[model samples]
Each structure stands twice: as structure tokens, then as C-alpha cells.
Target: MATIKDIAKQAGVSISTVSYALNGSPKVTPETTERILAIAKELNYIPNAAARSLKTRETKIIGIFLTDFSGAFYGDLLQGTKETLTRKGYELIVCSGKQSHWMLPERMIDGAIILDVTFDSEDLIRYADRGHKLVVLDRELAHPNINQVLLDNKAGATLATEYLIEEGHREIYAVTGPGSSYDSKQRLQAVMQVVERTAGVQLHVIEGDFNKEGGELAAKAIMAGRRDGQAAAAVFCFNDEMAIGMMNYIAEHHSDIQVGEHIHIIGFDNMELASYSQPRLSTIDYSKRKWGALAAEQLVKLINSDAVENERIYVTLLKGKSVGTSK
Candidate 1:
């Protein structure tokens, strides 16, 4: 690896001059700084992490922690966050460390962004416990030290349930995701509220793990043993994956079940693939990317600002075309 010594020799300046110029010190003249930078770039000189860390006490980089990155969820989130932060001269780091209960970067850097933490709040809590300046997206939490940003899970679910109710479908079947997720738990609770207000209406509930396989099995379970008048006309899945799985089963054996004809289907996330599906699954569309950006902005402002306290960020609801009927 090329070193500062190499650049200094090439730029024909003293080592001290090179250091001052490259590190953006005020003592260095603008003309010298430009010349040193040009020489360093020409040589493809990469600064030592430790040396750079000592100088800036900041990497101007954000660490991103998330479970799954395959679907629209993490992709959209990264895009939104990168657009905002990088434009402001910050870089991002993505680490898929789902195996560990918590994460401690091998090297220290500035700040963090956590997404869909999946019940392992311990790592974050511990980080915040140490007064780490960080932001969280999607998990509804707050602390004196850490800033939080999350979706209005109850509101979104309530809106979806209300839409289903208005579709003239009284008997509804609900497929819930694995019981662990904050979003899943809140969403199921919201559906329960709808069931309570509308008397004699039953919403069948099943457990899924927020994946396609879970959805397939849940639907098969429902279809195999559905009692007379108990099987719902439409099933509301916890997310697009489960909905798609349910759709797959419906297509394979129950080919007669047409979306909006025999049974209606709805999903969450409004993932890109959701629209391309056979009937084009209807889902809730919210900006995970915006969610990511908001979370980062709040945390950075809180930590960097001289303000003594941090504030909270709220979420919005998005409506999509999964519901096929009208009241």
C-alpha cells in the first residue's frame, strides 16, 4: 500500500506538509493542499484506518445493522438513507450480522442505524446504555441517549382492516407473522380492535414466520380443515411474502380460487414483486427509505446538536390495491 511518505516524495513536499495538506489542517496553504491531494490520488494512496481515526475522531461513516436485505424492505431503506446522508458528505457501512445477539464493530466509528432489529434490542440497548449515538428505524422505542423512529403499526393495520371491512366481507381470516416482531404484534392487536367493534364478525388468526413457506403452510392448514362458513372470503396476510405463499398454494391445487372472485388477498410492504404477481397483490405502501432517512437525521441532529434532549420521529400509512371489492 502506498503511504504518505510516498506521496510527499512524489509531491516534492516535506512529510509534515503532506500530513497537514491531506488531513485538511488550516496551517497548510491551499495551493500546497491541492498539489498534495493530486499526488495522493495519482498514487491511489489509502490512509491507514487507525491513523485516520485518530485525526478526525470520526469516520464520517454510519454503520447499518439489519437482518434480511433480500426483499424490497432493506433495499428501499438503504437507497433513501444513502441519498440523504451521502449528499451531505457521509458514507455508509452495511453489516448483516443476524447471527450475533449484538454487534460491536472491530473498529470504532461515528454513529449507527439499526433496521428491523427482530427482538434483539439487547445489542442496541447495550450500545445506548453506553451512550452510543445511534438511530433506529421501524422498532418503536425511546431512550434518553438513543433516538428512535418507527412506523405507526396500529394505524396502518387499522386502515387495512377498515378497508377490508368496507369491502362487504364480514368474515375475515388474518395470517399473523411470527409472534416476535414488533410490527407483527402491533398489527395483530390492531386487527383485534376491528373485530371487537364489529360484533359477530370473526377473524381467524394463524401464525406465520413472515416468509413464503410460512404463508403456504398457513393457507394449507386453513384450507385443509376450514369448517363450513368459517373459511374467510378474503385473507389478510402479515406481509407480501406470506401473501405470495398463500397465492402459490391457491394457484397449484385450488386453481378455481380467483382473486377478487372467490377469495381476495392482501399483503403488506407493497414490495416491487407484489405488483408483478398474477393478480397483482394489493398491499400497504410506505417509504422505508424515508423511514431510514428520518431515523438517521433525528439521531445525527440529536448527537451533533448542542441540545440536551432528543426528540421522536413518527411514521405514515400507505394504501395500495390489494383489496378488490367495494362496500
Candidate 2:
């Protein structure tokens, strides 16, 4: 509720003198600076960050935008981003939804790392054209002001599908995330490519929402189709959450169809819960923390006008009891 004007009036000094003293300008004498500080403390004056940023053009704050904050998948990633930003002398703010998009254009944050599909690629490019620095985690944009630090979704999908095929599965199903998701699109493209070229692999595709519920739905569909005498099925759920859901469905309803024996499963994003599932989930593993850290790092470099190339977080196949050879 206090302003520099009030401090200046109380100290019997000009407003400009108060401003200089508060900002530690050498033009103001130490006696005047100390006097102004004492008055400011008495008034409990808090400097306006928005006004300060207007003058300096650097907020020293970075924003990370996500679609939502409900999943375990984002925990390690956000922690990594926060740690890296703090190390770089910047602060991190997590944002979501359309309302928060204004922060980037309004200069509320010095830079942004975008992982939200709700954000239009065109809008991001427009922001880049206007000299806003960005690091994209979910989509591709070819602007000098923007950098890409995306996951190797295609490679992970290929690895998961290939692993299923190697385990001797002929009836393979691929459960995908929302159609709007860039990660889902990339992973599906790779899964389909691998299935198409492989001999005698019957590929079934199911639309999923990258949630546990979506996995449960896919499991229902798989069971409904199994009445046609399909002995064993290998399913590649786009993410571990969905895989866990499907496993839960099978364990609860189809008690006879044991995971790892009758229903081999593989998933992307080796989430923490994947290992603790009834039978450990076989999955494509990548460090979400490292992905987030790289995105934050690249965003800082972009903001500094340093040269940065596009970055990709690689993946590995983690074997688990949930995936076994089809007999």
C-alpha cells in the first residue's frame, strides 16, 4: 500500500531522489540513502516488480507452461526445470491454460518453456517474431528466437513395438494419447511404421487419452475382440499411466488372463509407478528430469542470444515382468 511518492513526501526529498536511493544509485548520498531506507522500512514499502521490469527489461523470471498439473509424469520434470532455473539466477513459475499465455507477450517473464498443446504453434511463432525467446517441448517451430528440446518419441515407440515383436507377439495393439498431442502423434507414427514393415504382425490401434481411464477402455476393447480366439495379445500403451490402467482392468475383471503371460504389455514413459504395478511394466525409459533441465537451459541460452541447437532426450527399453513371450 506504500509508494515511493509517500516515502519521498515523508523524507522531504524529491521523488526522483527516493527512486535513486532505493535502487542504490551512486548519485544519491549515503546519508540520504540510509534516511530513505529507514523511511521505506517504516512505511513497509515494497518495490513494484512490474514497474522495475519496465525500466530494466529483465524480470529474471522464467515460466514453464503445461496443459495441466495432475500427473506424476510432470513431477520430476518440473523439479528439474525449477532447480536449473534457480541455479541460473532465475525464478520459475508454472503456468497453465489460455489465461497464462499473456505472460510471455506482456513480458511478465523473461522467457518460457512450452509443453502445452493448448498453445497454438502460430501464436508461439508470432511471439518469436516479436523477439520473445522460447523453448518448445511438444511441437516444432523454426524461429531463431525459439529452441526445441523435445523427447525422442519416435525412437521410444519403435523400441517398444520392436520389443513386443521380439517377444513373439503376433496380435499387437497400440493405445495412443489424445490426437492433439504432439508426443502421441510422433509415437503412433513410429509404432505404425514398425508394425507395417514387420512380417505377420497384426496391428490394432486404439485411441487413448494418456490416462488410466483410457487404458481401462482399451483393455475392454481388447477383451471384446479376444472372443475371436486370439490366445495372447501384446499391447503398447503410449504412456505408463494407461498401461497401468489396462493392467488394473485385467487384474480385476479377467482374473484368468494374467499379465506377462496372457497379456504382454509395454508402455512409454517409465513412470515411478510402472515398476510397482502388479507385474512390473515393461516400458521405454527416458529421464523426464533431464528433459526438463535441458529445456530450461536452452531457454536461458535463447534469452541470452547464445547459439543453441535443437535438443532431443533419448530413451531406453526397460525390461519388466509385465512383458513376456507370447506362447
Provide the overall lDDT of each model, using Cα atoms, as 2-decimal numbers. 0.73, 0.92
TM for every model, in the order presented, reads 0.86, 0.92
Q: Which segments of candidate 1 are over 4 A away from where they belong? A: 6-14, 42-44, 98-107, 116-119, 227-232, 306-327
Top TM-score prediction, candidate number: 2
The per-prediction CA RMSD against the true structure, in angstroms, equals 3.2, 2.2
Candidate 1 matches the true fold with a TM-score of 0.86
Model 1 C-alpha lDDT per residue in residues 231-285, reported as the tens digit of each score: 3477789888899889999789787656655667778877787878877776777
Per-residue alpha-carbon lDDT of model 2 for 61-110, expressed as tens digits?
A: 99999999876799999999999999999999999999999999999999
Specify the poorest-scoring 10-residue window by lDDT in model 2.
318-327
State in Å the error of residue 82, model 2: 0.9
Query: What's model 2's TM-score?
Result: 0.92
